[model samples]
Target chain A: MPDTVATGPGPAPSGTALRELTFGEAIREALAEEMRRDPRVVLLGEDVAEAGTPFKVVKGLVEEFGKDRVVDTPISEAGFTGLAVGAAMTGLRPIVDIMFGDFLALIMDQVVNQAAKIHYMSGGKWKVPMVIRATMGATRRSAAQHSQSLHAWPSHVPGLKVAIPSTPYDAKGLLKAAIRDDNPIVFFEDKISYAKVKGPVPDEDYVIPLGVADIKREGRDITLVATSSMVQVALGAAAMLEEIGINAEVVDPRTTWPLDEKTLIESVRKTSRCIVVDEGYYRYGITGEIASVIAEGAFYDLDGPVRRIGARHVPVPFSPPLEDATVPTERDLFTMARQMCNK
Target chain B: MATAPNPATTGVEAGTPLRMYRQMIAIRLFEERVNDLYTRALMPGLAHLYIGEEAVAVGICEALRADDYITSTHRGHGHCLAKGAAPHLMFAELLGKEAGYCKGKGGSMHIADPATGNLGANAIVGGGAALATGAAYASKVLGQGRVAVCFFGEGALGQGVLYESMNLAQLWKLPVIYACENNLYNEYTHYSETTAGDPVARPAAFGLPAETVDGQDVRAVHAAASRMVERARRGDGPGFLLLNTYRFRGHHVGDIAREYYRPKHEEQHWMAERDPVALHAAWLVSEGLADQAMLDRIEKEVAAEMDAAVEFAQNAPYPDPQRVDEDVYA
Candidate 1:
């Protein structure tokens, strides 16, 4: 029932050829558009305004909106995150860039304790209207500290919402929705998918509401639940499965916290098999949560056990082969899907 | 350059000093009451007392209007009182009663009177620094002359966030004052153990017209805060003020074992020799601003007010247990 593209052949949006943007560009567009929409909106983080950050996602924003609105903070994660809390509590919509998801540990007190808990602790007297956007995932070989998927951290906490957008369309929509959201939200941008992932994102402003899942591919054999950049990997695995005559459906849960379990449950019920593919570590991770949801809801409907494909539990290595081995890829998803299909 | 107003003649009317004296007395007594309540086991959890640092809150708050903001620290009772928080409501919050400011949700550390411009009392050491920066940034962007005063301790300086926030505040010329209350300690460790270089020099690194004031002297704090507040109001820039003060009590209410950390004599020296309350009471009598009888009257009045607050908190109802699951999302 969602407006997301149900079946993907990679590119053809039927008759209408929509405007395109890379995932990172979509994020920048969302920031610029949101700032233009609301004067209270401001961007701050290390090199966010002056240098446009490492990914150049916030480029030209400072020139357009001026420095006062677009802030370039010193390299202090805890400080800037705390400022985000303060600014949001008083009167400002601050988009704080935590740089990398791994650096989340640095500002955990601000992000988890102060920002996430303020509204709840204040007995709903205060609303923390702030967005903490951090880059996540692996494959670029940024090494242990920089490359990691820690959306599970914020997702576990109450009084916070986590949005992990896989496509440019999802990126623009989810990020905008996150900015407009009254509660504190963490937007996780897949670093690998930033430039690599491209989709037709309409120029006109639209917010894909949080907690909705998008079915990227329609199939009958098995359901592949994916998040963020993992969506692409799942779709790729689905294509591989098609060669073997195993039709695999890929579902992208744009927002992790308020996960669209209804859509997932519906897909799993129809397919009767599920394999949750995640780039994050496997032990007690998102894959487990997704698999559990499927087992709990569509237990009897599942002919095959709900399998999970996730990165091994360890620090992401620097070597390309080791890193590839550490993070679960399309091949890993294919193996999991094949096993679920009894191939 | 705008001339700063003489505190005694201009901001002071016939009853302003007396009113401020009453406020100082109220904060001191309110903290003392919190100590007594926590000691009696009537109040659960920890309370960071504001016993010795009363002058900073009273002096700084007296110089600004109600619209001016303040971000408080763990030792926030004094700040809350000086910024016009109702003692009964504050007690209700501390008691976890439904009638509290945070509706029995936020206890001593998180007590906030948004209506009175007391943004919050942060439990995290340097958590409020950026908040005050953000609030001041809001004022600057809104084109409002309202200034935000951040009340932190010497320990908060060690927090990198404070430095980062200070840089942003200076860069944007935000209407915020980083009021550092150097209470000579960060938890059990002495400030000298954690702090490096100079506390004043830290903010001065950002080119803010930084100055250290005597935290014991109410008049001195008021005068300095008045200048900084004026400058900020006129769009000059942010000011960094470090108030040299000490705590007569432990870090929290239950941290009574003082001999394990600093010498008992050291606390005795601060409590007896450099007590802000005693100093201010003596200053009032000597300066002919108020005689002993007037000061006694103020004390008596504050005690009565504290008694009413305590009584009100005692009689207030507890929040419904069913309400615990609510207020998480909104």
Candidate 2:
């Protein structure tokens, strides 16, 4: 492979100001650009203003936007989540951060019942244009409550559009589009990838529309579908599989709902074998969804059964070794992909 | 909009005792008609009658400007009628017809009319507090000088969001008033079984001014609400009113099995002596604001209006099934 062979998807950063940014910095830039674009856009969550949040994804936002716009809320998930929906209804583009993904259950009534159903239940009389950001993934040993990923919950909901960006470039582009989208959306940020993932993001403003998937690596032997932080795992597994003469195509369904089924089906069709990977637990999780959708829509193209690799069905443990055992590793994915290729 | 200079301060349009009496008559008759329709199966679903708590909505609403906002609870017909929602459209919503305020998609517990500043009646307990706070925030940011009134029950105190919204409301001094209609019971359980701490002092813990009023006495409730609404409009922070009242009817139309809950003597005590509608009517007569004939005429007119509303709801068409899923997203 050469630099002349075009290593990345889409056009090269179309501005002279292209630079590498950490995932958190890319998200902050996205929020700043959108807030500058629309005055109604405001950020509200616990510790958003004074502390820049626990992950510092929204660091320095309070200085750019005043304290009024960049708000710090009390630790009331259900309360403020409902308040965000209320603010969205009246005339505010509220971007609420849940701090940790597991705490979304505290606001499940407001999020799933109210925010997701308000537009439909009101017969189009109201639109809840808001974004809820939650930090997900299980590597930092935040323990069971903080580290677990819950993308599967939002994906099952009807009205909400879910997005899990795997890279800084996608994080910036997809977040801007989500902020502008009129529907209520749940945007999941991989805590494990926030600082570890970096890519060339353009300084110029742009948006990556929701419900579209990005091809991170092109291959022909077997199709690998991944999500969030697991996208990196799939790419790593692809490199490992290539040593045995297996070429694995990697597809990131950036947005969970309104999936780019066409790209996935085409990739699966070309490869005639498929494997899905997700940070969520294997049972009743996103991996099951992708595997089933491919089997249903592109069954004729499959050479064998479509497989999946995901976290085991158990609470994420406190100890390092037990937690490590709970999550699927790159080598685990390698075994599944190699089994798919019979290599 | 401040009607607090006097206990009987006249509202901008419908503030006099006579007009307020007429409004109360309309609400009482409207709820009776809705109860009748639900019994006959002409309308579907449970209608939380605004039977015993008329003064809470009427008195509080009389102090509001037309542009001011209100977030209502499940037992919200009185609030809607007091806020100027057309009874015909309200009946239409109950009947699941296209002519409803929410075009029949939102039924009794979820009726909302943004055009009239009725943010919507929430099915979930304490759900509307957050929305009302946000509406008040919008009023402040828009510089509209408008105020928001949130109508919740004593049961809402058990909800965590109530305290959350109150803290935020006082912290920013948003132009909003929290009106709690402590109707003695939450569905079947006594409110004492669910609530904790003193009701009036609850909001005060958040440093917001809160008071308890006689919800049966329209004049007292009106005076207290007027004072609160006036303070909110001046950006003086939010106020809370704990209005003690009782419901004469069952919680819903089908909830007639009351033996397991409060004693029959309690219902008789409220209905026999402290009926809000009857109390207000007696006051109107004692004050020489209306005679027996005048009160009789108002009831007849309201009854006729109720008949028309029922007829209109019956004649209105159901919404097309194709439109059911149209609004799930943008």
lDDT leader: 2
* Docking level of model 2: medium
Lowest-sum lDDT 10-residue window in model 1 chain B: B1-10
> Residue A40 in candidate 1 has what lDDT?
90
Interface RMSD of 1: 1.5
Model 1 stretches with alpha carbons more than 4 Å out: A1-17, B1-15
Question: What TM-score does chain B alone reach in each candidate, compared with the true chain B?
Answer: 0.94, 0.95
Q: A7 in model 2: Cα distance from truth in Å?
A: 9.6
lDDT of 1 by residue, A1-343 (tens): 1223222332334565577678888899999999999999999888988789888889899999998888887778877788778778778898998889999999898888788888867767778899999999987888899999998889889888999888888888889999999989999998867777777877567888999998989899999999887887788889899999999888988888898999999999999989898877898888898899889999999896788878889899899999888877888889878887889
Q: What is the docking quality class of candidate 1?
A: medium
TM-score of chain B of 2: 0.95
Best-fitting candidate, scored by TM-score: 2
Model 2 TM-score, 2 decimals: 0.94
For every prediction, compared with the true complex, DockQ reads: 0.59, 0.59
